[model samples]
Target: GRQGSRSVPQIIDDWGDYGAGVGQVAASRMAYRYAWSTTLDLE
Candidate 1:
């Protein structure tokens, strides 16, 4: 989640726009934290 956020600015710069994909990536990573916390195998 934090890593995704860190890359956001770089992604925005690379793509030359603040678009939906960046938001999706960050959101997905944030959600993954919950899953990882709940399951040892996935983690």
Candidate 2:
């Protein structure tokens, strides 16, 4: 979703709150998927 979790100060500066919100949502989704896949919890 995001272009890697790398910090893009320039983009944040350019896109402002809207860009930050999109990135935040994307990063959170990616993190959730990763944790779910890597864990061994059956439930």
Q: What is the C-alpha lDDT of each candidate?
A: 0.75, 0.82
Pick by lDDT: which candidate is best? 2
Best by TM-score: 2
Clashing pairs in 2: none
Task: Encode model 1's per-residue lDDT on 1-43: one tens digit a residue.
Answer: 5744656677667675556678888999988987887797665
Candidate 2 lDDT, tens digit per residue, 1-42? 476664679667768978888999999999999899878575
**What's the true lDDT of residue 35 in model 2?**
91
Worst 10 residues of 2 by lDDT: 1-10
Reference-based lDDT, residue 36, model 1: 81
Error of 1 at 20 (Å): 0.5
